[model samples]
Target: MFTATPSHNGYSKTQSLLHESFWLDNPERPSAKSPVNQDIEVDLVVIGAGFTGLWSALEAAIENPNWKIVVLEGDRIACGATGRNGGFVSASLTHGFSNGLSRWPEEMTELLRMGSQNLEEMGDRISQLDIKCDWLVSGEIDVATQEYQADELQQVHSEMNKLGVSAQYFTAEEIRARIDSPIYQGALFDPQVAVVDPARLAWGLARELERMGVKIFEHSKVIELQDSGTLVRAKVGAHWVSGRLVVLATNAYPPLLKRLKHLIVPVYDYVLVTEPLTSEQRKSIGWLNREGVGDSGNQFHYYRITEDGRILFGGYDAHYHGKAGVKPEFDTDPDSFARLADHFVQTFPQLAEVNFTHGWGGAIDTCSRFSAFWGKAHGGKTVYVAGFTGLGVGASRFAALTSLDLLQGRETPRTKLRMVRTKPLPFPPEPFRSWVIAWTTKSLQKADRENGKRNLWLRLLDSLGLGFDS
Candidate 1:
């Protein structure tokens, strides 16, 4: 297992860094829209301007061109997890093939098809709309660093083959020949992943939504939602936006609904991006295809190459601050940055001298099921979805479509799936929540060290189909 010690070889490289999401640090980022200043009435009111909210508004606008849609965001567009991710838009609605198969075996085949189609449509939408956010169908490689992980990945490859999923299993030498990482014991390559400039994608979506006549208001946080006869009214500070239907796409932030409080917990994930690699530096790693890469560990690291030749490294530490909630103060973690830098060097010692330029963190809306779930409230006038668990980039579009189906009372293939119909097991409230998370995290780390052997705690979680991840 990779060491989490802060004093490792690459610690000092994290000293000088821009503490912000690399995707959001762009001169081309669109300016914020006006905030809601007065009571407004619309056919639909979508809360949150992240990918889900934007996609909700976009899809709704495309389906009903005459309907008036308003989007309210607490901060700038994509300022939340939408802009703060590794940008690996995977075609996996259920996190991954294994997780989906384990949780919803009966619907796994259909789910896989839908997820792939969703990704294809998403790419088509981006292309047709001319939204240039570096959309690359570069695929993703899940590398096994340990011998046991290699065996497990090989087993997964065989299962995927039986399921008719197109994937390639590579031996250590074969995998290393592609990426040139010494620790790669084996790899499973899934050609259904894409990487993008996530913040750019969100901004472009917002732009197109506005072009389609969707009213978006940034810095307008919906504090309260109430049922008023037929319409649902959401309070945004001193203002209110009432609509016949309301869609809550507020991921990771405090849910407007009371039941969502225990259903999802905000788990923080950190990231670091290096300065653009020199030609020589890039050649040393031999990652020419720019496929997104992740290690096969309970506490794994996902790293990908940027368009400009830099590497974005993240994952490993899924930190939960209990009842602290989501705060800006938690955006930068020194220990996490140090550990990531150390691991970055450990993975590619040939690029040990590469200096990181950016470091940031964002909270993931983690549920026990480790995938997205939907719910309805306010007498079915409002529908909400959350718990993408860090794989929401591509899934958010599918989530938006599913949420819309639920909101509009449509019985589509998406809404009929058990994965969409069922909600994850609610976490035990408060203090126990913290205790359970701490214990689970410790056990996961121990499993990583012990060749992926599950302890009693993890075994029980597996039995219940409930666990935590980032």
Candidate 2:
């Protein structure tokens, strides 16, 4: 919707950027787990081995050591959004404070507390399990490149202070001192966020689950799930596996359940990673803390320094293909990569010589509310969680635990929350879905360009509490 023709000259020099994730391109990636070979029965069966599935398996295994857990993956672990994200582990379970406040004003305090606890527990797990995934609690800084955004950040800073959340507002000069980006007008720093090597985190979780005696099968796609009397039968290739309980952790893919089609849409998000910065190059940009940086725009860009000093820049253009399905070919979009590269140079003119070494894209499970929702099927024997939008790196753990609670019929603090008890407005089918998405995308783009002024269509969507984002 926000179309910007990229300059062919700058991108031409980096035409052959690798199509793999920088976090996943390591030589230490774990070998694939064996696929399901024969009929099997387990206490619990988990589908889709991303963060949600891995965390669900890990939590279930820890809760009941004797419960035989089996995880099925269509491909290798972390090969989806788990591997191809900007890796900003955030504690905001409702996407962000503003979104949380707007959606659940009454339960925001509890949600915030739970989100913070989730992040703390994640840190504890990483330490306790010795998962060396470059877990840096470096926090995040949201910068404003426009005057209107700067005013908005100031208001957000005040609101956060009132809400008892620790935050700091930086002036243009102050923010430029922290990260020498010429485009920065102001910034808000939140200390509860972290950046990590996402692929390593996924791999560590998989290894720990295996250590806990959970059997994980790679290349074993669950073609069909039939709800039998007391068990759910899943067809995986030539094998049929039955389980007492099933968890559907598949996000943004062609779901095994038809109900999920209306609740989730695969919005492709693009990213580009620059080669590791030299000492002098890093010094030039004064990012001493290496906190994750995101622009304050409807169409925003999230950039961060990887553990290896490379800058992973992503976001802005969320592409939705017709039919809204995730495919391998959608992972690399030349135009999106070029636009990102161009923006990177605009943000930091001093780094114009730095060429991107990797460019890739991943599908985000976007819902109307821009947060996750939970549901059950097959008479409560099966549970599913999806629509993480774009902030599931940390919240997936919470979703996993909550899904487990739902499947086991346990009432906990997380399960009692209204956010979990409700579902987002389902998207209409087919042509209407595509038209609404395109119109909303265009409106969001217009808002960003017009000093954040919402159009009538966006206002109507806001009134109805229905909108789309990635």
Candidate 3:
């Protein structure tokens, strides 16, 4: 069911697209603040002003009102994956229920409870702070594009219900009545997900942090971290911010800690946002509820309707550029955009005339386990977190809180979980790393084409707990 080559219509629709994220393309975006010019001392220093960093600062300031907190960002706030995501705020901290069930079935119940609590607290904080980010609590539907996938989704649905999770399994005819997609064989709908303007959420958190007396510096990248006596010194340009504790929230970017260099690989994902749909075009799709939709595949697509009725379609091709790392030039991939455009048209033939106005790509910090891992450096004075894969929007707050718990040496419920106590199996070093990822990608694509049958390579990875079930 995949389009082998993009047609002329697909290519033409994206010919004049803007290479920027639709969420960040806002006129009301705040201007960048001045970077650190001189040495400063603070109680807590959080690096990177994305969702994780902002949430860390906010929570820290709330817990200790008098503590001096400083946030350092390399660019404007939320310019990285934080700004370039599909904005699905899921409650599953372990990527999804099945992934968590597979990896740590013993603590899956606690993990689910903690994830749900984290999401509720986040929503409460957003309401308490009055952060306007087009927050919508319209749940998510994982649709099966193939018949085998439907059977798999049904199994997942049954398992979820047994765990006291609320879910609805939709048949082909039942789902088509709701979403009007031709390829949906069946679907599993989880009513615990939400969507937001992610960039705006980050910005609003930054605004609230500043209002709470947290000092923030934009365009200041932390190049080095050193242990200076009892305090950790973060070098931003020529200036140093010395702090009693530091939180590393730099997800997907090159890490300041050397050990992290092998624990994560920045894999690029692309997205396309179409212009707002007219009334006639809107009626053609019949997506009145505007729920976030994702296909059930190893390689899949996630699409949703924006506030203004535009469709934000992303995922499918996860590109790893060997060791080029994260760079501005890799933000645009024409082939990925064309493929997405073709897939979009195929999914909604009535929207064949729709044109995309924005196209972008950003890297996701992929780990072997496809979830986050936490560690401390400089003898537990500095705590760091990465590897949220692509589902960090809501989990970032939990990560922030847990990192704080570690920095303060507190034995909270969040710290005792096996998922928190253990780390993912490190990825193989360079050359071989590239070879492994390439082969994995090829095998995943092959499986998608062959009725979800895993070959030896994928099965081996699955046995090793690295194969992503989607």
Residue-wise C-alpha lDDT for candidate 3, range 128-180, written one tens digit per residue: 99999988989999999999999999999999999999999999999999988
TM-score versus the correct structure, for each prediction: 0.99, 0.99, 0.99
- Answer with 1 or 2, whichever has the higher lDDT: 1
lDDT of 1: 0.94
Native-to-model Cα distance after best TM-score fit, residue 304 in candidate 2, in Å? 0.3
Residue-pair clashes per candidate: 0, 0, 0
Task: Name the Cα RMSD for model 2.
Answer: 1.2
| Regions of candidate 1 where Cα sits further than 4 Å from its true position | none
- Alpha-carbon lDDT, every model: 0.94, 0.93, 0.92
lDDT (10s digit) by residue, model 2, range 1-470: 22367888546845989999888899989877789999999999999999999999999999999999999999999999999999999999998899889999999999999999999999999999999999999999999999999999999999889889999999999999989988899999999998999999999999999899899999999999999899999999988999999999999999999999999899999999998999988988999998999998899999999888889999999998969489999999988898888888889888888878998999999999999999999999999999999999999999999999999999999999999999999999998999899999999988998999999999999999998888
Candidate 2: pairs in clash: none
Question: RMSD for each model, in Å, please?
Answer: 0.8, 1.2, 1.0
